[model samples]
Target: MLEFVVCFTVVAILGGLLLQRLWHYRAEAERAAVQMVIANIRSALEIKVAQANLPDGSLDFTFLTEENPLNLLKVKPVNYAGEWYRPSGADIGAGNWCFDRADKTLLYLLNNVNSFEDSQTKLLKFKVKLTRLPHSPAKPSGAPETLGVAFEQVKD
Candidate 1:
């Protein structure tokens, strides 16, 4: 009886440990996925800005969300895997990132949906900043514009 009880306890403890490890791995995977989505969106935006030839050689805030300005950028809409990524604050069902063009900076929010409970392991909230640095535009030679991109995880 003693042997049987001890064996059962050991197995239970091992199972619990395995479950905890798996949960940690799952959270890390979610964070990586969110970061990759944000990176792709940023790349697309940079390409769009370079092709647009803005009068001031900087990204116009309106191009981030407004359809009219977006069309003029000549960059394909953000697409990943087999789905199309829509604008932020739109139906988030098919998208993982949201775009916010506030004042002078552009913001990309990764994993914008907060579906996890307070007690549950939550995905990281990545806030990517896109700032247009001040520089003189190259005269008519079509040099690509320079923009600064930075990212930080927001703690809730």
Candidate 2:
């Protein structure tokens, strides 16, 4: 009886530990996937900006900020749920990507909330906007300031 009890307790402890580790790994994987999507969107934005600049040099960026960032991508991510004006959690559900046109923000609903750090919100919000790079001292004083688009995280 004593040996059986000890074995049972050991198994329970091991199982709990394994479950905890799995959750940790799952959270890390989720974060990595979100990062990869953000990187791809940023790359697409850079390409769009470059293409616009090729024409003349003066390119209007106001339109880009209002446009859906995913539209710039050749192929949208499979998990993207599409655009919504003002979506609730129930509207989009968990483990999906949604763009809120009203707020001009891209949101990622997290599937695993256990290991995620944000206690206030289960979703991650990001935005694409025009950003100006600092003028390089190496360049001449008369040189034009460099402008680019940035994919930035927004707290909501």
Candidate 3:
């Protein structure tokens, strides 16, 4: 009887540890998804700047999902938290983006960042920034001479 009890206790402890690890993995996966979205957006912008020769590349929030020169639209269009990145028309909901033509900067703002995580105390906000530089004729074309993008998480 004592042997059976010890085995049950060990099983319970292992199960609890597994569950905790599972949650951690889920949170990490969520973070990675968000990072992927930012990377794709940055890549598209870089291509557009080089190929299209866009001086400023100022675009609206809807441009991220629009089909054309950049073609960044996804069929599902869902973020990590299973949320829709709607167009910035009358609503301008989650996953909104803006590009400044004058400053050559692109900014993405996502709402309800904490919803992606299990802990209530882990409040976060995601901001993606892209900057474009002036490319000269003397520069090479192997890399992006005109643009760069960065992503950051903010505590809110």
Highest TM-score, which number? Answer: 2
Off by over 4 Å in 1: 54-61, 65-130, 136-156
- Superposition TM-score, candidate 2 onto the true structure: 0.85
Computed on alpha carbons, the lDDT of every model, listed in order, comes to 0.47, 0.85, 0.48
Candidate 2 segments exceeding 4 Å error: 56-58, 114-119, 136-145
Clashes of each: 0, 0, 0
lDDT of 3 by residue, 1-156 (tens): 999999999999999999988867765665666566657766765565454445565543334323221134343235322223332322333454443333233333444444364434322334445556577888888855455444344344
Q: After superposition on all CA atoms, how large is the RMSD of candidate 1?
A: 8.4
TM-score of each: 0.49, 0.85, 0.47
- Backbone clash total, candidate 3: 0
Give the winner by TM-score: 2 or 3. Answer: 2
Query: Cα lDDT of model 2 overall?
Result: 0.85
lDDT of 1 by residue, 115-139 (tens): 2333232223344455667667654
Q: What is the lDDT ranking, best to worst? A: 2, 3, 1
